[model samples]
Target: MSSTAAFYLLSTLGGYLVTSFLLLKYPTLLHQRKKQRFLSKHISHRGGAGENLENTMAAFQHPPGLPVYGIFQARTMEWIAIPFSRGVISAVTIGTDMLELDCHITKDEQVVVSHDENLKRSTGINVNISDLKYCELPPYLGKLDVSFQKACQCEGKDNRIPLLKEVFEAFPNTPINIDIKVNNNLLIKKVSELVKQYRREHITVWGNASYEIVEKCYKENSEIPILFSLQRVLLILGLFFTGLLPFVPIREQFFEIPMPSIILKLKEPHTMSRSQKFLIWLSDILLMRKALFDHLTARGIQVYIWVLNEEQEYKRAFDLGATGVMTDYPTKLKDFLHNFSE
Candidate 1:
């Protein structure tokens, strides 16, 4: 075909592709409104639960099976696994049903789950956790100086880095949320497969989701609760071609707003503005993300804010009508829910 003819053919095909994508993705998002309302109505806002412990980035273990909120722990976390696991295992053992972790592949392609694309902060060693072979990798506990005997509480137990499969085997019925750290489609596919092998109840997944990875996920299994965050979608569009992100049929858009940090305080310079802060979510958004959050929530998709550690902010997240707030301390969330419901 002539160059002009080839160009025309490709352009026509691309238009058809974009149309098909919008119809699939947007409608699923719209339909989620009823589900969102149901979730909002019944889920708790406060519990009479006791005073809670401070948590780090690793595991936020609560007792299993209570549907409070998913505990978030980053794989790129700096705390050693033993001390980390002490917290993580404790986080889950209490009552939390879900955990979010960052998953990436090493240079050898073994999946080493962690959040940062760079590992310098977490490992304190000069390396990307994703770029090292399992053997070349140092004992992770060495960095934290936490002894395995104390962390695992076993005389002869090994403290090697836990595998993706091992987590599934060890914690039956444990719900997981995996955030893909790299742009590898094949790696996401393998992780998806492993999720299927051990998935007993439900799983949630998110990522920077290069088009290839999200596309592969939807084509293979549509039932897994995949989230297409509004902020992330707009981000990918800005970063890549507009023609790309629309191809995936996403049922939910996880609009995550992290609780305030020193970084936020530095920029905005306010304290009582937390309710304002929860709405100030999408700090990464250079655009009007709050307007987008209202639009999405109005349509019925859930908007979950993360790490609502303080009582005032937790109350504000609910008062402002958020779908859910993720917390390191589910006990506090339960108390908030019970009191709110009363």
Candidate 2:
């Protein structure tokens, strides 16, 4: 090679080596370096389902260290018994730092708290929650299914649906996460009203599965932080792998994801066909990487994995730099957390 060409090639190679070394040794150097506003060591999914009834006031009354996430269901000009009900007032009585609830709008444009818009699964009534006035809603079934295990049931004395306003009024000081279960404009608007009325702009977060719904949430109230939807999660994953994450701007503060729910589904009896299992397993393995968690943490974004009921999974998630583990069993999680200090 000519002298000039050789010199150019060597210089390029040396630069590449130096850059690679720096990235490997000081991984956080490229991150945004913003201080984290919130830190969640443990979160209660569905208000600690395994500990009590999922989304019930009973469940919300668990240990206080972790954040509690519940669902909202509402109706107008009527009322009914929701076994899991007790209103946000009861949840606030439990005294948690944060809470997450699902939001759905009734036919009358009232905001209610509930995980599903339909009332059949929880109440065993073949009716939609929206169609019924708050008074006409049916009581929850004698027993409710626990999210963590199959064929499990939660039985408690309280069974009445509570209004969203009740929650905002009861818990003015707490940070609450509202997961929009449906794409209803009225629901979004009603939620925004409550947030503004209570002056909880900094403490409220909007979450939903669809990107469109997430957008509506922001449009309704731009002040609160939002959780990443599935599409956003995929986009973030792509950026991370391409080394473009640090350059990209992310407005959302939380990434609440199921640890491996797609694969976890396989554990359900007779649900997974052989071929489906293999595909799910492969996908699970690929996404279960510590680097992804570490990268997001370095950028000051909180990574929370959900519905983890087992102790082993809790350890794995934390070891991989997860900011928090959302579990159905808050008592069990508290025990696990206690084990660490003792």
| Top-lDDT structure, candidate number | 2
Off by over 4 Å in 1: 1-93, 141-160, 209-213, 230-250, 257-263, 266-300, 329-335, 338-342
Compute each candidate's TM-score over C-alphas.
0.56, 0.80
lDDT tens digits, residue span 1-342, model 2: 999999999999887667644553355676555555566676766665654555655555443322223321111312232233333334334333456667777777778777888888888877887897777767666567776665656665556566778767766776677888988888888889888888888777786979999998887788877889999988987776666565566778888877664345426748778887777777666566678777667667788877676667777778877887776655456556656446
**Whole-model lDDT values for every prediction:** 0.48, 0.68
- Candidate 2 displacement at residue 12 in angstroms: 7.2
lDDT against true structure, model 2: 0.68
* Candidate 2, poorest ten consecutive residues by summed lDDT: 71-80
Error of 2 at 222 (Å): 1.6
What's the residue-level lDDT of 92 in candidate 1? 43
Q: lDDT, candidate 1, residue 112? A: 56
Residue-level error in angstroms, candidate 1, position 110 = 2.7
